[model samples]
Target: MKLNIAFFGSSLVSSYWNGAATYYRGIIRALAERGHTVTFYEPDAFDRQKHRDMEDPSWARVRVYQPTEEAALAQLKEAAKADIVVKASGVGVLDEWLEQAVLEYCGDSTTIFWDVDAPATLARVKENANDPFRELIPEYDMVLTYGGGNPVIDEYTKLGAQYCQPIYNALDPSTHHPVEPDSRFSSALLGFLGNRLPDREARVKEFFFKPAQQLHDKQFLLGGSGWEDVAQTIPNLDYAGHIYTRDHNAFNCSPLAVLNINRDSMAATGFSPPTRVFEAAGAAACLIMDYWQGVEQFLEPDTEVLVARNGDEVTAHLQNLSVERAKSIGQAARARVLAEHTYSHRAEQFEQIMKAERTSRAYV
Candidate 1:
């Protein structure tokens, strides 16, 4: 069937300063390349001008909706026109009433609660009994996750999610390929982008900052937003706030090694790898990541990726690996991602899930 799809989220169609937005852009574009018509809906409240990160995707049509109750209701009504409607997590603008309205107005449309941040969403639902959207989990035709593996599936299913599938983050080779090495952002040990949850912030300090502080002679670079006030007291520490998505390859190219840190919940629950990991690896930058459950599924420890459990391990990896060895590891990781973790692969999985859900609904 030729599906006309509409994606609803906080910042999909729009280029928001979040990984979910990138995921949305990549996956939707891939889906469009496969011949699906996808329309994206996002709020216009955010500063769309600061979107220096990604190019205006040519594949999908984007519509920025008004950020008012009446306007949201209007969007819901418009969404009813599509064959499939996807409500992604972290639309920052959605409230209980908005979520309820999405369910109420999505008449005959296959609705998907695509939880990009499963751990965070589940935590919210657990804490609030009055959260109206909690009861609507199972109401959706299917649930799609960005990274969480089995544990996330169990949590959502326990909360009455009928069907859940892990979509997982993937690499977009066109945008993230190895570039000529540069020295501007180069470091013997470096870290790139992220700042949201305090837990992740702390992990970055533990895994990256502390190590940099300890290895006084080694250089470290930090990228991403919300770190403007982050104290840069250490001599080796360098802060590059908010690198655009388009410059990700150039930024990664400069780093002899890059650090990857997962959120505390993701690390504890396991199987969640942020897009940055693949993004860095896609650029063939050596990755030194914190120890997380299911790290092996994506890359082998010590070979494909350097695993760090503490500051000491991180320092050791940076000190021990030669540039040639680091480059080789990065190259291997990049090959793995290109082979298994690309937006095209993700879109294929998404198509399969939609097809299976449609067939099941027919029988029901």
Candidate 2:
């Protein structure tokens, strides 16, 4: 049966400005490829004029919503007709009341809370013990996490969620693949592009900044927002500000090696590889990642990726590794991602999960 799904997510689908939109486009397109009808509902809070990437593809239908009660109610009415309703995490436009209202409109359709940031969400829930939504976990049919392995699932299940699963991040080969290296940023030792992670700042310093400082001959580039005022003793570290999503491959190619610093929550949860890992790998750039529990599961150490335990380890890799060896590792990682991790693979897993849910409901 062809399933009709209502996907409520943050940001305009047409404007692939953020990482969330990239995720949306990948999964939604994959779903469409599998013969599913997806109606994407996005709140127009951000400026649509500032779209930094490609326009919406022809596969999925998009619906824009307003903040008013009438607009939300109307969208809810339309959503009720779908076989499944997925309220993605971090729908920034909707207020708390609207989120609750959307959940309440589950009415015969399977309601899934697709949490993109499980660590942050879990952290918030833990901090707010009195939050009513904490208890609302059990009400949803299932809770889906973008990444975070067994630990995340166990935590969600313990928090009263009926079922929880990790979808995991994967590369979109169509968008990210072996690209011609950009010569401008090619001489840099390490390049990191990620938003502010307060808890993981230490890890960033240890694995990235410190190493760049130690190797004064090598340059380090930092991309993404919220680092203008952060104190940096390292004169070699260059801030690139925010790089657009479309230009990510060039940014990755510009650096001889890219640095991936997992947020503290993601590292603690385990098996949570961010989108940048796949993106960098897909771009065929050597990746130096901070040590994490499930690092081996996604990328093999020394073979597919270089594992950096501390600033010293990072510096050692930068100084010891030749450009030829780094390129070989990058190629291997790209091959691994192309074979095992992609949006198509994720879509297949999603179908299996939904099928299980439907079958179980039928028996009940």
Best by TM-score: 1
TM-score of 1: 0.95
Expressed as tens digits, the lDDT of each residue in 1-364 for candidate 1 is 6789988876653344666767777788889989999888777666753563544468877777777888878888888899998888877675566667767899589988888889988888899987777889988888899878999999899999889989988888877888886666865467667754676887877887788788888788887777766646777778877677767787888877888888888888889988888888899988889898999999888889999888889888878989899889998999899988899999999889889888998899
Q: What is candidate 2's lDDT per residue for 1-364, written digit by digit as tens?
A: 6899998887534333355766777788888988999998877666642553556668888887785677877888899899999888887766465557767776689998899889889988889998767977888889998888888898898899999999888888887776776665666778988766577688877777788778888788888767776526667888877777777898887787898988888877878888889988998889988888888888899999998878899888988888898899999999998889888999999999999999999999
The 0-to-1 C-alpha lDDT of every candidate, in the order given, reads 0.81, 0.82
Worst 10 residues of 2 by lDDT: 11-20
Candidate 2 scores a C-alpha RMSD against the true structure in Å of 2.1
Error of 2 at 83 (Å): 1.0
- TM-score each candidate: 0.95, 0.93
